[model samples]
Target chain A: MPPLKSAATPVASVLAADARHTVTVVLNGTPRTGQAHPRLLLSDFLRHELGAHGTRVGCEHGVCGACTVRIDGVAQRACLTLAVQADGRRIDTVEGLSQSNQGPTEGRMTALQEAFRRHHALQCGFCTAGILMSLSDYLGRNPKPTEEELRDMLSGHLCRCTGYAGIVRAVMDVTGQAAACDTRSGEAAHV
Target chain B: MKPASFDYLRPATVADALAALAAGGDDARVIAGGQSLMPMLNMRLVQPRLLIDLSRLEELRTLKADSGWLSVGAAVTQAELLSRPTLRDEVPLLAAALPWVGHFQTRNRGTVCGSVAHADPSAEMPLCLVATGGAVVLRNAKRRRTVAAADFFVGPLTTVKAADEIVESVRFPLAAAGSGHAFREVSMRHGDFAITACAATVDGTQASLAVGGVADRPTLRSWPLVGGALLSDLDAALNAFAWDLGGDDDQHATARYRRDLVRRIGRTVLEEALSCRR
Candidate 1:
């Protein structure tokens, strides 16, 4: 662990006033140091500062999972987290999920992406990034999560248009390595 | 929404944190994990002049069990506490209650001490602490003292935590063999704050029950194990307990309804605890 550094000086006196706090975080794979306000939401830092706009912010409060991202490999709502709280931590946005491919696979979409396309999981696509990010983290832990577990894990996310049938199919398809029906479970598949 | 303007101070040590709190006086708010404080700030419910961020103060974020007592740092996050193997083994009631707290996302950022300080009557941690005979350690610039859980809470969202004092840690008595614990609550959703909550601890022939959400503060009751009509006695005691505490009606439920639910849930939890002992 790195030595915790004290603030250089009192930057400002007010809450809305921008006060600078040094935050050293690993965005994607590279370590970056920056000054941010105490009020700067982590989602804004990723979208505006680092230009990783893939991390969406639907509901600024914690109710919506649209701004979900991996902080130290744990799925969290970035909008509800302060930039300063993420100091000296590893953060993985949707951008980090794609970097695993190399050579001929460089810049290629991930297995999850391919599964989403094959299962037609997205419609309007507004909630795809967060849903994918949360599911990626969830599946990483429970690759073979039961149908009930999948439903429970996805409960945090909201998809206004798709009705969640397609998304559930996409997740099941990816995890089951099946094209359709997700035959692993005898329950009738929605999509 | 942006938080109201305030001076920020990240103290590296507990002494420094306490000194900063004393210096800032009543206008200072100590923030740990910032899970609850940040939301309150964004909503402008509290606009303190100075924020004593205790995140860097690692000494105040630990969990240790010894000599039949479990000591927990006030800054320890709900996630951290729930994940600790010792807490899981020794204090499973806390572990069971933690998952019902504000979902995984908030739990990752919310601290155990912060929840206790916030004192949301609907929250799980405070009621668990109260049921386990927990004591909060308070440190001010000059002195330190411990407040028993029963006396710590004064009313809804209020506590005896003084303005100049910071909660350093909380200690809970470890449950002995033949002691069983149970917690249950009802909410609109899994992650939503509880509408009514109850925690019960049964140690041999003695029982301690703490009810939250339906009261201004957690209402507690103690009694010896009765020989006959266990459910009826528990229900009658819970009803009397709620009436004695003067529980009021809120948007969630009527005062009568809350008292009824308390009786129902309290009896259920007590029964569960009793069964676990067998």
Candidate 2:
């Protein structure tokens, strides 16, 4: 049996369902705090309470990747996480991607964003943020990934537009595999 | 979909978690990674009155080898276990199956023991557990017990764990010399629930195959390696096991197709495991 600690601190604490608890997080390098009930999700907290509207919530049950966000440096589903659970964590959403180089009001875009624009990777743009966040984290870890590897990694996100061809092309271009980009040139502009 | 209202408890120690579960009784649910439970909670598939978060308990996060078994603690995430450099040489079946468990994003937050505790019929963790003859370590306020993976799962999304018992860790027996393992699954999408998942282990003259997604729980069948005309006998045995593990005709696939997968993929995994054996 594991021995009990001698500290006088309470072993357990419960946050009531109806009661609101103060939730704090480091949102995109800025410390932010909000009040939420136990049932409130992190996706809803980021959008409604913290004003980080870049993270979208599609299927709240964890199937869809629209709610992808970086928590403690890894991409995770915001909809699948509770607001109170992320109280002291560092969260990075799509808004943080572009804000790194310039302020949120600036017009500059990252190399991956530029590549996406050049390849027309997104049409409706609803799923672009989550996709970008996932790919950004993946490419940072796997800098020179093959097209097949990129496709496998993209399985985490869903995109109804562009058929994922242009997205794959854009990722390939960002990975310095531009020589193979022309193989899908005919499908790139159309997608 | 949104979860119903529930009181949240963050316990700093395993003792506190067990005490909370005992105090909350049948209404309390233990959450480690929340990868599986969050979906059920969001869809209101299970709405508990109290949820005890065990993420803060550092003692439940160890993943190391002890004697002849690889002991994986409850809070060790799937990605954390997968990232272990010695995993492939230590447990090849788990190495092959971990990538097929949901997506890379979910694995980053999904705990290995949590998946075993969830006991999803289509999940890879439980299938690997049953195939490798692993054990689940369960603890309550008073005592601790270890249940074999085969007996741990009672039905789909159901396990033998009592309401007050929390899974502490899971132990997978280390693969010995002259043994090989393989795992394969067929799903609609890359990261979707498998229609039929199979795992096989070839050790000496004995071989065992575990099939999932074709039954309420993962089922295992073993066969002895014979010298002459073994393929025919093995096919007949696999055919019978596939029929015995009858599946339901659902939106993803028909019962006939699932059995077909069992017959085909089961043989393929077994052969693959046999080919890799020393």
TM-score of chain A of each: 0.83, 0.85
lDDT of 1 by residue, B14-85 (tens): 887787788888888888877677777777888888777786566887789978888888778787887787
Model 1 residue A52 CA deviation in Å: 1.9
Top candidate on DockQ is: 2
State residue B46's C-alpha deviation in candidate 2, in Å: 1.3
DockQ, per model, reads: 0.32, 0.62
Candidate 2 deviant stretches above 4 angstroms:
A1-12, A102-107, A180-191, B227-232
TM-score of chain A of 2: 0.85
User: What's the interface RMS deviation of candidate 2?
Assistant: 1.9
Which candidate gets the maximum lDDT versus the true structure? 2
In candidate 2, list every pair of residues with a backbone clash. Answer: none
